[model samples]
Target: MACSLCIGTVLPILRRMRRLAVLLLLVLPHGASRGLEREAFEVYHQRRRAVSEAHPDGLILLLGYERQEAQAVRSPFRQENNFYYLTGWNEPGAALLLIPAQGDGSVYQELLFLPPDDPSHEKWHGPRAAPDDADIRSQTGFESVLPISKLATRLSRAAKKRSHVYTLFPHRAGEGKQPEPDRREKLQTHAGELPIADIRAQLEAMRAVKSEGEIRLIRKAVDASIAAHIEAWQEIEAGLYEYQILGPMLAAMINGGCLRPAYAPIIGSGPNSTALHYTAGRRRLEPGEVVVMDVGGEYAHYAADLTRTVPVDGVFTERQREIYDLVLYVQRKVIAAVKPGETLRGLTHKAKRYFDEAGRDAAGEAMGASFLHGVGHSVGLGVHDPIDFSQPLKAGMVITIEPGLYLPEEDLGVRIEDMVLVTENGAQLLSKGLPKEADEIEKLMRGR
Candidate 1:
């Protein structure tokens, strides 16, 4: 009886411990005590360490997008990629400053500067965190948070210390706009003695590898996108405008938790499909034409890219199947060859060989020539996330393998795309449950 009593007491304690562990995972972000979806503190810290290693004793400054003036249309805000990478602060008009450790590697500091909260403005735009908000430290895990006005004074002090400022200062419009009387002007003139480097290349190389948390978010995006594609495949019919099909596509993804489409949804039908990046989703479908739906969505700021060519009707024509099968054959070969240490160039070359050897028409015109554009690109925070395409594939990288054959003469285009994650041994298809084979697609459409 005493042993039974002890067992009962131990079980409840163990259950309570498990519950606490799950709670910690849910609230892992240091300043996320209020239940916001903040990126785990480790992600930003790891990236900061990477930058520090690249430029020890240097100051890294990253600017964020400015809040747009109130106008007729107010779009949701998007965070800057580089700034988000370092701090994961979702608010607009914020900036990040990172100071690498001292010569003894003992003084690493990361500060997030923010716009002070104004109750009057908050009445219009909703409540926002101030520099002194307790949540700022918990949500961002930054060593310090300060008001935006302090930025000028801080930069002046750093300038006097002769610190090299590494930043993407000459940013193009719409990439990420800076505040008025741009801080960049100060960096150039006040810190004229210090040399500034772009540091974008270093960040790109680091972002190429995905962490476990990042992969989970990416997987969520791919799953939502697959659902959107399936909805399009089932609802498409002759005489329906491309936008009509896009309606269900958007609904499905949004309902599945995607914030928005990763890129402009490409719904190209018939001759329109011949254009690589067609965005006009207004074309009405015809009985015999094929449609290409290149669509994906973002989940937690991560992006997914997927493309599938489907017939307007339930089944493919004899000629359409031939081209589709050829692209599929090349895609399968390329996917099977993906593994750590493999180069994208080598895989593209292999695809070219297959297309040449088996895809030539009777006229001796190599059909492979129609295969324009690279086979794939990395996908992450940005749809076409910056990556070294020629570098060897490494584990933890998520990329898309899209191979297409556009035959303008025949008014036919076929492209198949799938997001893949590099693994220790080979590659894992993040979009595995999605049907890509012609037979499977036909079956799904017929069932609808």
Candidate 2:
């Protein structure tokens, strides 16, 4: 412990010693364009800039992440996707600052502070930023990039003139550390780690409506998911185990440019399907049994979430048909309900009514124990992207309407999901190629 503290204290001086030589090599190859990464990064910067300007007073956004555990052990921190979105620095222990466009153009107005590299450290782990990580600055287009220790100083200054700090830091916002009140030197918060509800309004207000570019990326994500699902279904057979289907499906996603799984690939067979959050790898599929797969792929880091429950063989059993049709009908009705003004919570209540109404006619006492979970959730960087908790939907919103009916006793669950985009005409289904109709799915299963 004593040696660790000595190293930490001495590192700053060591970093300064190497700063001059490193600064001279500031310019690198300058060709780090990774296709979709570059595109998404551009959109992310523009929107973050807009958020700063929208509030005018300035926003202090704090974001965090967790890492994939290393070969011996996975690291606890995976950089928050949003933080990676704006800054493109995947390292943990980093923060970004977007100072409302300077009254006069200056270098450090909108900046990013990241952990600087150390040779002794990198030798133990891996490469990190040098004293001159201008490539990071150039790629992210931030005004400047500096060490993270400077953040409180930066915030202290911004709070002097501006009055609020908008952040995506707290997981369940409005509950943690609310900013200290200083009407004389006010600080606003977006996701109020509250006691300071002062900044919550702008946080929800900005992220609720998707921009045109955001919608385009989400559409691409949906298209990739459709391709993955179709591929998963095409290889399906009664003898194949449920988890076997996930490999190829996810293959299509990676090849199709979905860099990450929207969440986990849930390829559930038999009663396993009844477990809503099943993470795959299980039971063999029987001829007449239904398979419920809730899978999603991330394209340009935006999520494409979809769920489809289908027969393992070429046809559905009579009992399967009854529940499948009911699920499809309710899902269709819910899709129709996704206009430009429905709150997910409100729409969920409406969907629950349909499920209950159907129960009244068919199963009667089932929904309580059987049809567990909500209709669906918001999808984005973190699968359930944080945005708009208290507002009505707008045009660019992308949502999934999946109304499922699960019967564990009978060993069946039917859920058909499609990602829909809110449009001027109504809703546009982005996963059109997956063939959800009973006839279409059965025929596809039959190999015709």
Candidate 3:
């Protein structure tokens, strides 16, 4: 009788232990919740470490915006670049708070504030992660996750001792809007005499240089862009409308996993070619005219920019070849001078000098007059990513080298652009596979 009683109790205990083990296995920590890999979250950790090191006594606050689904049609939500840089969290209306260590036996603290999931609303939309989710902390690598409603009260209590708080105030054009007004007021109300400092400068400086992972994402964007340009070369004909060619090219980019265009694809034929930034690709191509196609693709939030000009009928006329070759020559020279220790202004000066000495119009006006814009700009999360143009080029910096000449009188324009990566020794042409030479473009167009 004693043996049978002991067996019954032992069996129940063993079953409960098995259930607990399975539960623990189901909740193993994930690197990120979305499609992001572990490396991305590691990048976030590195950024947080850097911020904490710089501001040992302060707290960093960054607010994320919820998608305005009510105001517009539903679409995929994109997190602000700066916020995404620090945390791989992709949801909307979230807030992040970080407290740095002062080495007084204090520990660094990172917290994420999240909105609750409403089942009634989720029936119309979809369910979202809540503060109590174990993945919320695991995926974001945040120390703790709490309700967003607790932000003001919690921050106010922490800052009551006159602690410094750093945030991204004084928004720039491309930067997202500031934190919610009520929350901003509440933080200030509790801050008393403590002043809020802007951290934009520090963040921009950190983003200017490409890390290994960032370079990989950028290369994916550039490769997709190159494929799109090649498709455009194959499809351009003397009788097709500009949009007709653009349609297939864009399809190719999207099919290749680039869901967004870096910017509007600029397909300008004939007179439209003379108008920079002409995006209305409604013109029909005619034989003996040049078409300038400037388009790129964005992959994983990184961008690629490229421009190529070609003859509409697969052949360049004598005058067309003259202008094309001249522009190509100067473009190559500028690209060759893209090593470190060079500033954008210095490169622009060199381009101007080269154009002045090499070519002239009928009345002897300098070809440099037709050069309308700066030599190039940095490319990254934004097509025209923010940068200090006066700062010397650094290794891992990616930029575009484009030189052009537009002659409205003759109804002619020629531009050649390529993406380049500044390396330790010099530069590497990321878009080298695309044909830019007049002969090569013509040969490719002829299906040779």
Candidate 4:
């Protein structure tokens, strides 16, 4: 009678627990239930192998951002770019160590160090993967997963055997407050005499060339950004605040599944448009004024950069059309020149020459003088993704062709920007879906 009573009571409780588990699984995000949303394990695995091959005798160490405590006001956490590039692990307070193959027949090894699970922390922040979790290896693509407490010991051991420690060093002086400075200081104590090689250049080169998966993500970002721009065009008109136009664009980006803007969106109207990097969207647009809308969306950490200057009244005035046409002409000329073996500096020079020869500003000066910024920049993980400006363009590389003429005297600024992919033979415009022609833009705004 006692056994029967115990079994009867426990069966109902077990069924209840099972039902709760099922309900939670249905409610949680796919990435949360598994791990952070990321590419396949092999993509990261291949990248690690390539890095190991590059530095066969040295140890590569990458430190991720430390986890921040929950606060009333705190920015969302983003993983360190280089670390995320190598390992797809997005969780904070993780570290990656790559041990090169040894001559003594030891194989190349990669290890991921994760913070120990704190039940108290999880109570507030939700559950995080512990090193001992069953699926940690498959999730992180690192066969050897260990507690972060083991990081120093592992690095010390590896440093003693390795000839050099390869990691990102500060690129310049007075950058003491940057993320790299603190991480490098800590690495020095652990690395001791092992000469530290600045691996930043190599990583930048690797990141310049997008993998197939990265391009897909970038295309998604571009698509979302284009949709957002269209929304803005439909809603823009005279007497509306600059931010009022920005509202619809942001909504479109979010609805299209973008995580955030590539950078702060810039919506400058009238005189404000003449200021480069203008983000303040407070001005009330007036008739016959041009508003420069420089915006893009970031999807899955990849970024898209685009800019369009349109008339507030849905029609460009005579002077606006003239400057706009010159800017568009120069942009097309520069983009047409994009191909293998062409340097960004070269393309920039070409753009300036085109601007100078094509037209003059209201002040009778060369129009190129009005072009304040570089013609283009590498775009990927960063809106202005880092690359050696002198390096020649290669296939699979994505860059922007943006040419703008800012004439503060005329209170006019016109910029045409698009993302381009360097192809085997020529260039392919990734953001071609967005219309740049004045007629097309007017039609779009007029809903004709």
Please tell me which predicted candidate would have the highest lDDT against the true structure: 4
Query: TM-score of the candidate numbered 3?
Result: 0.84
TM-score of each: 0.86, 0.75, 0.84, 0.88
For each candidate, how many residue pairs have backbone atoms clashing (under 3 Å)? 3, 17, 0, 0
Q: Name the best candidate (by TM-score).
A: 4
Better of 1 and 3 by lDDT: 1
Which 10-residue window of candidate 2 scores lowest in summed lDDT?
26-35
Tens digits of per-residue lDDT, candidate 1, 215-315, equal 98888888878988997887778877887778767766665567678778999999988889898887889998899999998877788899999999989
Cα lDDT listed for each candidate: 0.79, 0.65, 0.77, 0.83
Model 2, span 340-446: residue lDDT tens? 77777777777778877765534557453455666766665556665554457777777778888777777788888887777876788877777888888888777
lDDT of 3 by residue, 1-448 (tens): 9999988757754654454344334323421121232246768888978986888777788876566621224445666667777777767878888877665666777888988877996896688888987687675677688999888776776664436888765445542123322245544654556787777789878887888887887887788778778877877777678887676566556544565677778999999999888888888889889999999987776788999999998999999999999999999999999999898778888888889989688768998999887788888766787687798999999988998999999889888888899999988998898889888998998992
Could you tell me the C-alpha RMSD of candidate 3 in Å?
A: 16.2
Please say which candidate is ahead in TM-score: 1 or 4. 4
Query: Which ranges of candidate 3 are over 4 A from the true structure?
Result: 1-39, 69-75, 170-193
**Which portions of model 2 show Cα errors greater than 4 Å?**
1-36, 40-45, 54-78, 84-89, 101-108, 120-131, 152-169, 173-201, 356-363, 366-370, 387-390
Pairs that collide, model 1: 30-138, 31-138, 31-139
